[model samples]
Target: MAKDLQERNHLVRWGILIGLSFFSLATIFILIIDFEILRNPDITQDHHFRIALFILVIYFTIYATSGFIRYLARYLNNRYLTRFTALPKLSSYQESFTRSYFPNKPYEHIVILLHGFTASPQEFQFLIKHLEANNIPYISPKIIGFGISSTHLLSLAHRHDWYRVAIEKYDLASSLANKVSIVGHSMGGILATFVAMHRPVHQLILSGPGLHSAPSDLKYKRLLSLPIISSLYIRIVPYLPKPIRKGRQTTSDTLDQTHTGTMFQYLAIPINCVKEVFSAQDDVDITKTQSDQLTIVYGKHDLTVNMSALFQQLDHHNTPYNKMSFNNSAHNVLEDYDKEYCCQYIINLLKNPQKTNPISKLKKQSTTQVQADA
Candidate 1:
């Protein structure tokens, strides 16, 4: 038994050493690319070169230390060394649902669903299932800050930068789909509006949408601006000991069940990104301007968004929009409530163009007056 124990210990030590070495090599490779080591010829006696070397060394030390500490923490906290794992494969139901519902229709209309902050495309899985059932082809791209996408925007400095990239990519993707409709929830809704104003999309749907900073929003903005406070807050927010953030809690009453083995991707979105998005003044007036269609859907029990503020903004914009509300749903109305109804509504819009009038009422009135005068 003593010999067997010694052999196991030897294997564990080797494994940790191997893991640390691999991490160091990967870090070095990334640093080389970031510094453009191969392309830059004037490295000798250059201050930039020296700065890069110093930064690389600091990064290497920090990363190496982190890896070692993490490995030690795992061993000390648990008896077994946990192996790195991949994301879960799509289940039989999910596979069949994807194949059946998202059939490659001549790719006429593209429906882009942008999830809320700290959420992945997984949040829209239920909605996707329903869209598939209705044979509506859709693209649920994981925004830069979430899912498999890069988390560089999660930092306080680049927080809103993700939206610009997201919009550009979304427009490119939509051009292939012919007509595009943007659907966003929470902060994503704010982005959807920004896209609607700038990018050429067929329609817009805002669900429990996030809006620009008001006097009230400044309080949260100030909190996020503090460097140390924001970093610490973000690190702990994902793994909060309680089920809620601040006083805000999901209305689901049931114990906040966590999906095990799921990864929470980090993003470094900054306040400037938010400011830039909010500060943009579009030439198009939503109320006076007619688009394909604009719909704002909210849940009566939504915990994240202030409904009154959202309505006021829409009203001020003079955007010709319809408001739909779910009775007892939270922020995730498409998943927690009537997803089928939402999917069908989207389908009906795609099939019947007349449902969403593109021409302004002012134009119609002018034409009518001209005919009467003639």
Candidate 2:
């Protein structure tokens, strides 16, 4: 299956390259013909060629303008962020530090929180409060590249570094507590799976896992997954605008509107960083995963991951897992619209690890809904 996926990805990459090559060649040929027509007024009678040239020129104009804006945005962002790159003290960035919460009672059970890509431990702030109030011991570790202002450092870090840091944090939690559960969001969900594969996890809760990207992100995913094309592509355009929320839905609930403190990369992210995410995801095989220890919490409005593809993979693997869905939430389920219900649901699961039926513990909400099986 892995080999087949790889072959398909290769074909997609080559197809994209071929399509772009043909478009470029056609544009050049049209330009040459137009120049000849201008030099010889009698040849200007070719109306079909003139129409084609006009269309291609308009397309090129839009593409070039978009590319220029992306490159300029990357340049300014990098220049601003480079100031923090030299700072020896990570403490300067409060969000960058790993957060650990040890209750008054001795640690019998502990939960490890992993934040998503381009996001910090701050994403779990509300959830952390709930965990603390309930006297639940938890540790939220900051991934190596995240929580810092420097996109350059983020680009430098690879998937291996992310996997290593997560495993180390898991090992630390294992030493402190008899039982440990992993609660991961987005990219963290991917890391959590890898950690579970390496060690024994009491429970695994994934919030909008990055196993499969949304339909909108599929083109970018395919383009960046290629080795040679991605490397060259990044050099030309290092960053692109991050997808924005449509309708009235907003991320204001998840992040503070007044605070300049960077909890998430709202503007844009390095293309190389995106490539690293795809690399980590490629290492994960859903068929080999142990679904018995897994529970998925996702949002119906999520645009970051393809829910249809995720469901297909789960059903095909016959991976039995407790699935919860929130209509009001997007990718950030922790502090999204259904946050109150989401946090309570997670707290109940952590408190009663033995209870496999998630629906039985939490009261069903009319506004938000849950699906029992995957």
lDDT of 2 at 262: 42
- TM-score to true structure, per model: 0.52, 0.65
What is the C-alpha local distance difference test score of each model? Answer: 0.56, 0.74
Q: Lowest summed-lDDT stretch of 10 residues in model 2?
A: 85-94
**Cα TM-score of candidate 1:** 0.52
**How high is the lDDT of residue 318 in model 1?**
66
Residue 305's lDDT within candidate 1 is: 50
Residue 311 in model 1: lDDT: 73
Q: Which stretches of candidate 2 lie over 4 Å from their true place?
A: 1-106, 245-263, 290-292, 354-374
Candidate achieving the largest lDDT? 2
- Residue-by-residue lDDT tens digits, candidate 2, 1-374: 43433432343344445556656776777767645666665766566667877687667755655565566556655565554533221112233444576554367888999999888999898899989989999999989888886777886887877887887798789778988899999999999888877678887999999998767677888998787998899999988766555542343323223333444654578778888888788887655654336788987777777767877898987887777987777778786777767887888788875553454344455234455421
